[model samples]
Target: MLKNSLDCIEETGKGDISIWLTRGNEEDNFNYLNIMDTAKGIYPKQAEKIFESFYSDRKGGTGVGLAYCKMLMKTAGGDIYCKGKFNQFAHFILKFPKID
Candidate 1:
């Protein structure tokens, strides 16, 4: 994820990747991390598509990064999703299920 954000900065001359982590709430299903980047953000329509394997716009980009991340999170009983605005920023939130 950092690489993706860094690449965006490298390509666009905009550099801002904010990573925030939080503890899961015992009484509620919670998100533990947020990765927001000021890179060339995704359009609302592309948000879902970004998680698809082999989907990429950049040259030589295999497009497996986010897809892999989604799979990994699911396997660990968590969920991953992206929220972003076109030409603005992309925010990735990772939610982990509550544990006893």
Candidate 2:
């Protein structure tokens, strides 16, 4: 996920990236890591599709990075999501449950 954010920043050539960590409610029992980047973001249609395997819009991009990350997160009882707009910004949220 960090790599993806770095790539987005590199692609934009001029933007900022911010990270936020927060704790979820007691019912949720999860910790959230939000990575937001001020870059050329993706379209709404691409938001969910970006997590699909082998889906990349960039040259020489295999698109496996995000898919793999999602798989790993799920395996660890977590999940990942993305939200953003074209030429605006991209925000990725990763949620992991707290360990007892």
Candidate 3:
């Protein structure tokens, strides 16, 4: 996903790019997540709506991936979140409580 986002950024030449990877918590054992891009302007707002079913800027997506991810995580006791700018970039966080 990081690679794809970077590729997308490079292709569009729209924003500054960077990636951060953090280890999962010992207590929750959440899946490790990678956050990429320097989301600044519209991306944050865009992200919120992106999770909605049947939503997509591109014609190809049924706009269900993120929404599905959210549902799957909830079923497993986790949550996903995103924040960023419209013109800048965005950050996404997926957290799962440490499972024993």
Candidate 4:
């Protein structure tokens, strides 16, 4: 997650990143760690495609980072996703089930 955030920071070089913990919807039954970058964001189309293997736009990028993250999150019974607008911000949310 930090790697992905740092990549966004370096890619845009415009604004800083913030990370915090938050609870999900009651029905959702999970907690979340949100990492948001104020730098320029990707298009919605690109965002949808980012988790696919070898789907990077960065030069020399292997495009394995996000794909791996998604896999790992699923393995742990959690999930990761992104939200943002082009040239505005990038928000990455990692969600985990609540433990009693």
Candidate 3, superposed: residue stretches over 4 Å from native: 1-7, 14-32, 38-42
Per residue, candidate 1 scores C-alpha lDDT tens digits across 1-100 of 8888889989999868999988866666765789999879989889989899999988889989989999999998998999999789999899887665
Candidates' TM-scores? 0.87, 0.92, 0.67, 0.88
> What lDDT score goes with residue 31 in model 1?
56
Instruction: Compare the candidates by TM-score and give the number of the best one.
Output: 2
- lDDT string for model 3 (34-63, tens) is 465752334655878967877777546677
Residue 19 lDDT, candidate 4, scale 0-100: 90
Tell me the number of clashing residue pairs for each predicted model. Answer: 0, 0, 17, 0
Clashes of 4: 0
Against the true structure, what is every candidate's RMSD? 1.8, 1.2, 3.5, 1.5
Which scores better on lDDT, 3 or 4? 4
What's the true lDDT of residue 16 in model 3?
60
Which residue pairs in candidate 2 have backbone atoms (N, alpha carbon, C) closer than 3 angstroms, thus clashing? none
Residue 73, candidate 1: C-alpha displacement in angstroms: 0.4
Count clashing pairs, candidate 3: 17
Model 2 residue 97 distance off true place after TM-score fit, in angstroms: 0.9
